[model samples]
Target: MSQHSENTPILEARNLIKVLGGNRVLDSVNLDIGRGRVKVLIGPSGAGKSTLLQCLNFLTPPDSGHILLEGREVNAGSKKELCSFRQQVGMIFQDFNLFDHLSALENVRVALMKVRGMSKLDATERAVAELKRVGLVDRAAHYPANLSGGQKQRVAIARALAMDPKVMLLDEPTSALDPELIGEVLTVIRALAQGGMTMIMATHQISFSASLADEFIFMEKGRIVEHGSPAELLGKGVGSRTQAFCAKISELTGEADGEFRS
Candidate 1:
């Protein structure tokens, strides 16, 4: 992997809070993630992982807190500024949010054409390259309905990469795939991790997360209860609630410490 430009934290969230239906989905969450580092977010179900990711990317506005990307904050002062920041932050979802009417190639090409204003030829070329990077070049013409779960997820990943985003947030990317298909999607993520992309990934893939993550955050009931390196979080054990939750998952999956290497 190439060296990270600088060790400075590229994004920061301070005192973030979110509420839905009189429930606190996020509470006073604070995080500082460095550039070119993989930050894995982990926990049991409904732990606010998705909420945190959405808030950071402005997909869901924080109820009371602020998000700073590459040092400057996202504020209501200017639409241009907000657009600029939003473009720099890309996201991937469990549902593989590709347009049903568009082919994989077209999906990737859309942002480059509309957002970056690249020519069709240039965008197509870039889209092809990114699809190849995700091991989906041959599937470029396939639409979401025609592709397998893992294939669709890979196309989604390629779509995000085509935008050349500065920060990528992945929310349970493999959860929707069949048991046999998860590996294909994880492989693409592994490649990206090896390339030193800055990411805030909300995952249940403990093995991959442990092996690739520069840091791990464990959330429970709308708050971050513990956080550390892969080895630290899964090696020495975790809090009582986290330990119980992970243990339960381990039972069903036969291996809960997901994509992380021992």
Candidate 2:
């Protein structure tokens, strides 16, 4: 897959603001993600990564802002627009939000059968193909309760992939898994990136982001404080706060293969 062109942003956020419980979760946030690029969002726990993802997909309406998807305006003002916006953006959560009662294959088909107006047979074919892409083909008949964390996450990815979305948004996608399980999920993400899928992922895995992301966005105090390629964001003489956070996470990880590997 080719890298998306830099001329037009596939997803753009302008002066986005989101308030929760009277606290500003996202303030004056602005970003432009190139089409088919892999972008990473890194910040402290409360820096608003999750909220920004929600705002992008209409999971949580922003207080005030402009979101342009493929250059079309999507905001909270219009209910009809929100529904359309969601169909174009497929979101994957940290938790595999699967219905325990639904079989893995069923979960993938439900959205397509209901939203895309596809016949049950066609939906099953697409769902099965997506599950195979995520390496969950054999487990498609199993329930969430019977699958491993990695398997469940793969199912979630398949579900999102089945939508054939224009943009993919992930919020802390590896947070709930054990360290060993992280690699399996990241493998699927890397494959997606290699396929030139436009993505915005909020993650704590510095090494993965350092290697995979086309650009990095750093947030603090509910706003984007830095935006650049990974080399630029983690380069020498970066702002003290960003470097400090990076160093701390590096130390915690035990094995460092990033900017501070020396």
Candidate 3:
């Protein structure tokens, strides 16, 4: 790879397509995200935002597409390659996928010991540090059942961060939380963004995303309908799909137009 390619996008998805049950969900999607940049995906429910994220990580492998990391195409045919790819591209789901039997620390520690072959002592120390990063160190002994929605989500973030991924794919991370609990999770995400974490997040938190995202990508009917910086897309009279969608969301959420529109 050339130095320019290495200097550009840290991750790329080219012509990604996925069909399920005779219906095309992700249609020829293309995306590029550079290191330390944050992009937000916005669209209606079932717009294939989740599918795109899953496909990028090969959790739900695309029927046909190319995913490149640092300008090199991903080859997930080998189990070892897939495992390494997944570790590099950490994923956080809407529902906190913590192990029910493990405490917060153990939940973060398990993958390190199992996948990375870290010693138990090393994994435990790393887990403690990650939990502290997410502000959940005090709850390290609590299981998912005992943690609040926000706390569980924090633990999930910590688990992913523990791997030191090159990119983080977030699929509606706050969608499961109650209204009062959403801010805490968003705060953690905001901190990550400020700390230069690369992220591609699919979310409906338009106002929050517009404020933080380097770009807003709008998908509809399994395709990217619009893409641009938040100011370019959401500024008054821009007349973009993203702008209109955000307007509708603002109406539904009862936020003022000024909040979602620049």
Candidate 4:
């Protein structure tokens, strides 16, 4: 990439607004994500973090406002344009949205063949590599029914990775996993971060996120209540919304909130 492109945010959301069932789910939210950055979204259940992520990917189209990819505004209304845009941006849901009938490898390979028009051999090769990346190569032949929750989610991540996305938007990626299985998925995500993947994630894994995220964006009532470096917002003695929320979370989950720094 050129110097200008390298400096620009890989993704931007400007004044994003979204409503559902007569409620403003996303209220004029704005965000910027630079290359190789990790941003974590934290808030209560009804705080609209998921809605903001959905709108960013146009999964749930916004009511108004604009989405810019690499500094260029996107035309979300055009199917062709939206398809092209989505190819560059991946979404990982809390629930592993895998096809039950397809094996792990097939689940990852289908999108490459259908969307990118890759041949069977090439798609198979790419899918195997992705499955290996997520440490699920041994489970490649297994169907969703046969795999554990963590394995299924790994398959989901592999499917998304096959698209070669520029940015990843993950909404509570571990929310569906059992306590014992959460770490496996998180390890994969941590490796992705180490390898310079640009990502925005909404998660309740406070300590884990605080330890890794470049920024903590706290949302409430469909709006961003606070945003700053995790160290500043979550450091000891910081009187911030993120700190208060993390305290409450640490109380409930029994995980210390002190890892937000370094």
lDDT digits (tens) for residues 30-106 of candidate 2 = 98887788889998999999999998877887888899987778756788778777888889899989978999999
Residue 129 displacement (Å), model 2: 0.3
Q: CA lDDT of 128 in candidate 1?
A: 97
lDDT by residue for model 1 (157-240), tens: 989988878889999999988989999988898888888888999987776677888888889889999887766656544444
Model 2 residue pairs with clashes:
none
**Top-scoring candidate (lDDT):** 3
1-262 per-residue lDDT for model 4 (tens digits): 6888788999999999888888888899999999999999999998999999999988899989999999999998799999999999998999989998999999999989999999999999999999999999999999999999998888999999999999999999999999999999999999999999999999999878877899999999899999998888987777898888888888888776555432
Worst window of 10 by summed lDDT in candidate 4: 253-262
Higher-scoring candidate on lDDT, 2 or 3 = 3
- Residue 202 C-alpha lDDT in model 2: 94
All models, RMSD in angstroms: 3.2, 2.6, 1.4, 1.7
Q: Candidate 3 versus the native: TM-score?
A: 0.97
Instruction: For model 3, state the Cα shift of residue 155 in Å.
Output: 0.1
List the pairs of residues colliding in candidate 4. Answer: none
**lDDT of each model, Cα atoms only?**
0.84, 0.87, 0.93, 0.92
Kindly list the per-residue Cα lDDT of model 3 for residues 184-245, writing each as its tens digit: 99999999999999999999998888889999999998999999999899888788888888
For model 4, the local distance difference test gives: 0.92
Worst 10 residues of 2 by lDDT: 1-10
